[model samples]
Target: MSETPAASVSRRRLLARSGAVGAGIAFSGALTEVFAGTAAARGLGDRGYGPLVPDPNGLLDLPKGFRYRVLSREGDPLRSGEGRVPSNHDGMAAFGGRHGRVHLVRNHENRPTAAIRVPPVEGLTYDPAGAGGCTALTLDADGAVRSERVAIAGTAVNCAGGPTPWGTWLTCEETEDKAGTNGYTKDHGFVFETDPVDPRRTGAVPLTAMGRFQHEAIAVDPRSGAVYETEDAFQRPFGLFYRFLPDRPLGGTGSLRAGGRLQAMRVPGLPDLSSVQEPGARFGGVEWVDVPDPLAAGTPIRLQDFGPRGITHAQKLEGCYWGGRSVYFVSSYARSAEGSAADHFGQIWRYDPAGRWLTLVVVFGPDTGVQLPGESPDNICLAPSGGLMVCEDGGGAQHVYGVTRRGEVYALARNRQNPGTEEEPEWGEFAGVTFSPDGSTMYVNCYTPGTTFAVTGPWAGQPGR
Candidate 1:
């Protein structure tokens, strides 16, 4: 797969407003101030409903017809003899097999500075590179892995990913591969495509065109061949949203692992989009812009209408996915201008290409009163009833919360693992969630104890009351 450079696009010109605005281009401070006065002018109401805010003191909980169970846990031995799960297991994906089993592509978000290194043939261990990466596991659909192999040769810190209709996983490396002597490993940040079934048959192609920034989660539009992505920001500058458009579009055999154009989110005309006032201030009035020359032929459109002043910067935006007609994502860190908690809640936003919309679907802060900053809303899954399942990375304990279509928040399952027990509980303290294809079964992974869960029950569909 390392034969040559990607097939390059010849030129760049004005492409029609292909329905949804391309990416969230950066907005300038000047335009932000201007739009602040009229931020409410644009109609952002048609797309989505609000977020689900719930209480904390409560442990495992949910609304109705919903239930959860543990599938995999830390220290659990594998049939393949690969190894046990590491300290922090952050993200995962599921694949269907012809023989009643499911193939899962999971990530272990371990720290480079700590934790035990895994062995070969079964699991993976990094030498000095970044401390997170992916593993291929074959499960029995009952949520059991028959075998697991660390596919890619030297991948580190693999976070969230988007699945391909052609049947592949695009695992993103979050740590920037900035060598320049100060480099941690070998410039470890780039998207790699892998086969969930055949880990050894995988390919590691750095999407050089996608730019080399810290990548969080990636969601792709199978029909449009457009890939939507999010950045996970900790204490650094606010992470920006992005898009990668391939020349030929998605589908076919080997098309996904190759070339394309990458563009960062910029509210055109608005300078230095990084500098924003508060979390919910609302840049709702800003127009989307394109990045000029970005990574390839797809030059940024550069819209100058939306200003930066009214926009809310996501100090931490981790999870993102393209479900139905909208590109949806979650923000882990939310702050206020006074440095307090801005509404103090983490938020979820939906972006539509055709209708050109970005709606804040849910806000989980104000209700919990747990404004401890970046505690809730880790990875998320879209359930059947227009509901969302959220993982909490908060204080004292970790659990999964169920959000209803009516924006009602409830706890579905709590962590059974506590300080005293040597026996890890049913729900792993760490949370990573993925729903089965039919949406009947919900699979969750614990980040703390490194466990996997499968939740099943009578699930009610959307259009909630």
Candidate 2:
């Protein structure tokens, strides 16, 4: 992705202001003040797409000159003449399609009892009893959905996942449902690949070698095709970051089922590193330990094996995206209530493959109620303007936040969809924030009410672009 000159300058200024160019400084209250001040100084709040204009339909709030159109909604009829679109739309990926259009492979984070389910087809169902799966949508140049159909079916809790370099979506099951348990014939916690190009061409196949746990999201290294996964188990045992080194490179005709080695991340000096001191905290010289059993036998892989080994644990490791040769991930709201070392508003970590080090980038402070530009970032994607657009999954009104390369933060869009009274707008978290290949439109999903929207505007002037 290319960056515009203005965005390049903003990012350069951000690095200098945040001291990211320096060895690394602990991001604390003082640093937060500096960041806020820098945002004000650059008039970031007023620039880059300007303020959001409320939607008359009371669905989405976007900046001036920008407008959103609802692409698909829950309970909408499927083009396949099957069941309606499943609820709880989560992670999604955009792929270039025929006739200068885009195809979106979207996950439906439903369970066995979901009101609607992705219609199951022979050979595509992982567990006939499970209901969660993915749906593929083809969008025209105007961001209107042309066709929609089930991409994968019979999975469970199809949460956040990453796209592969070779044009495929890795849909991850976020449940540890065991075989012969809860009416499930097969184990649930696994990753399945779905091709948006032709949903019917590929069957849902579980990549069991990736390790079975409460999987959250994944990012693939385009160079080596190494898959990095994050676990979102939120308990005393928490979750660990994992790396899957495939026996062979994973693009082209590569298959994850061909088998790979799964390993857990371990920071040498920071054993059981749950209490991250502050954002910008750098842990270098990291190591990875082999996971004996990638497939969970009787217990979840992280708890039974990696947890006992003192693998560095994080609280609710959610959305992860690959950009700038690094994997940026989110830890949503680490606090005493969540059994974390410290009470944090949220944390964003960056893992540098070249340096083999993980560094804390942005940290939301302990003030949970504070309505800053962004907090509790969940699904993330790189902006065409060279920054990050983070989806908020926390309390209060949710928004999609834009972070300049220089670290200046601003709200890109806010959820104005309210089923209740206007005094108490029912805010739902945004997920699956992705940009079209040509950067003309951005797509995102509202978790509740289950809606997908296509947003278009003067994206080039946006802070992250």
Candidate 3:
């Protein structure tokens, strides 16, 4: 287990994605209140995680049962052409249409910045394009979005992915350019695979060892198609954390172009352990260090010497999900690597591949005595009862935080979905969270008005299970 190579991928152009997933999906909304639930702001239901409640930035104290509306924001007018949906939305996936319909596929982290550039829309993936990236709505089943596609075009900052069991939507590319020092002609970090429901064949193909850098969430073991990534890695400390394997196996979904094995995440010993509250031995508690050899031909092994011990609660570990078998994600950033700032906070670990281990359950510290009125906690999923939704990019108190499975922490909705006056919730704020295999309905997406929302009520347990 050993690895390192934070970004500068494109060993010479490789990753590729195709299209297929069109049976029908059209759910649009503008609702206000439905079978909602409330917990009176963190009651936590004795940890059964019941008393359910979310969607109450309603008045702004936002925490009780939870309630929210505004299905598709941003310039509005979704049919894919005109007005909005080009914001900064990130990570999504819902597919499963025809009658029991719902197809979402979204991700748009857009960050070229210049008074808000991103505007070249239309089945994106660079080709005379420049827009903010990611977009593919096509909801239905009480959510209504009929059609809207830009699957993955002209990508650069399009982040978050992992959703392909033959279904589509892999869109990642946390942007890291060095085209001669960064004018970024192309060769953006990698990972692109889409097909929301036809958008002229959403073009983009690049998975290249899955290293690159900055790629926020991705968890697709699918029983060994292998992929477990997360890296905001922030500040050039070189930002690392990954694992991608697929020379061909669980049928990882239509050709990424046979290029697998990339690893990083070492904690094995400690170069003198420098405070993450002095953690240097808890390493591999959540075990998954395999950067060795990757077919490079043996010996390589380093993968952070086997993670966890201090300095790993997400230097920016954006978001992740695989569901209870083990993967359970979260952690927006509590700092480490010298700047320091982590006395045990922002956590949710839970990794358990048949006893490999990594359980922290819920420990975002200032003291689970609990005090998160502000920020920290980017993307996490698994709620219906086992509780935990996190997502508070926290600005003017940006929320989406929910915790259960026996550790209550409420504050469900209030992203407002960015019509953008910026006063608050310049965007709905919830980034890269998905549900709807049968969780009834509760789809949220927003990184910058790159919208996608569908929240129905009476949510039963086992979300994302």
Tell me the number of clashing residue pairs for each predicted model: 54, 4, 63
**Can you tell me which runs of candidate 1 are displaced by over 4 Å?**
1-70, 118-130, 141-143, 177-185, 268-313, 337-343, 368-375, 419-429, 460-465
Candidate 2 per-residue C-alpha lDDT over 1-465 given as tens digits, one digit per residue, 9 for 90 to 100: 011335334533443453432221122322222223122223232234566778888788887788788899999898777678888888988999778889999998987767777778777777788888999999887677788988899899899888998898889888788887778888889998888977655687788889898898999998888899998885667888899998876645447778889998888766544477565678888888888678878677776555554677777788887765677777765655446776555677778889998887777542222334344567877666545677876544678977654554556798877655677555667899998998788999997788999888877663423
* Global lDDT scores for all candidate models: 0.53, 0.74, 0.51
Q: What's model 3's overall lDDT?
A: 0.51
Candidate 2 residue runs with Cα over 4 Å from true position? 1-46, 251-254, 272-274, 306-309, 366-374, 420-425, 462-465
Which whole-number lDDT from 0 to 100 does residue 144 have in model 3? Answer: 63
Worst-scoring 10-residue span by lDDT in model 3: 11-20
List model 1 lDDT by residue over 47-158, tens digit each.
1222223324323343344455555555666546666654456678777777677777777654454263333332222234545566667767566556765654345566
Write one digit per residue (lDDT tens) for candidate 3, span 1-465.
000123111100111111101111111110001001322222224223233343344322233333444566556655656435566666677888788777877766665552343456544446343344566666676666667755655667766766766677777766555343234555565676766676445366566566555576777766766677776644524345566767884663555556766755444433211233321123453334555343222221222343345323235566777653556555543434334343223554445566655444444532222233434566666555435565655333355666543344544455543454655333345676667777666677655544455666545533321
lDDT of 2 at 56: 84
